[model samples]
Target: MPPADIDIERATTDDLEAVADAWVRLARNQANHGSHVLADPNRETMLATLGAYQVDGGLLVARDRETVVGFASVTVERGSLALDCTRGLLSNLYVEPEYRGRGIGTALLEAAEDELRGRGVDICTLEAMAENESARRFYRQAGYDSFRIGFERTL
Candidate 1:
């Protein structure tokens, strides 16, 4: 599908369920790339999170005509008082599997950034699984670089 066909707009209360569904799919995909999340078990939590995002006007949906094809959720992250900049966190981004590579994800991401910028956010941050090379590459192409890296261990 052409990029022009996808419409990126703020998500409404009516979109919460669809956004949660997309989030679940995103979690399932991440699980294959080293994420430990349990998607199905977290449906209610995801719904609540989506509601919060909606309340903050940080939930965006990408629609191809009347059908929602993807969503991006963002939030302002204020660190300790010692931090230099308030960051806009791209908390979640996902496009339907069939919509991948059609520029929908990029549209959603850019829309998210614009939403943040409108709120006076000059910096942004997001996390992708270490093993998800495709996601890393996409972020790099979008002009993002890693300023922090995390390591985890299981006892």
Candidate 2:
């Protein structure tokens, strides 16, 4: 099937439910390796989180017709080790499983980059599980170069 037509736009208050559902699906997919299971976030939490993104001017959504097919959230933060004064963090980037490999993720990332650029972000950064080679490859193709390795241990 041809890729579904996607429309990228700013997420509104009314999009909270769809955004929350998308987050759940994406989180589950990301944690599919038996690493950990995340708790389902409540609608209020979703609203607050998205509200923060809006306040920071960093939320964008991709829609297929009236349904939200994908979304991304970018945040600007001060750089420590990097020479750049500020960098954009891809806090979240997700597309519905049915919508995967259909350019929706790419479009969402591009929209995020554009939004960050307009906000004076010099670099874009994101983290993917080391086991998720596909996500790593996608980011690499999207022009992201890994600068540091992350280590985590569960207590």
Best by TM-score: 1
Give the per-residue lDDT of model 2 (tens digit) for 1-155.
Answer: 22547788888877767887877777777677433647374445766787788666687888888898888988887655766367889888988878888888888888898888888888888988788888889999988889999777879
Instruction: Show the colliding residue pairs in model 1.
Output: none
Off by over 4 Å in 1: none
- The estimated TM-scores of all candidates read 0.95, 0.85
Candidate 1's TM-score: 0.95
Q: Tell me how candidate 1 scores on lDDT.
A: 0.90
Q: Pick the candidate with the highest lDDT.
A: 1
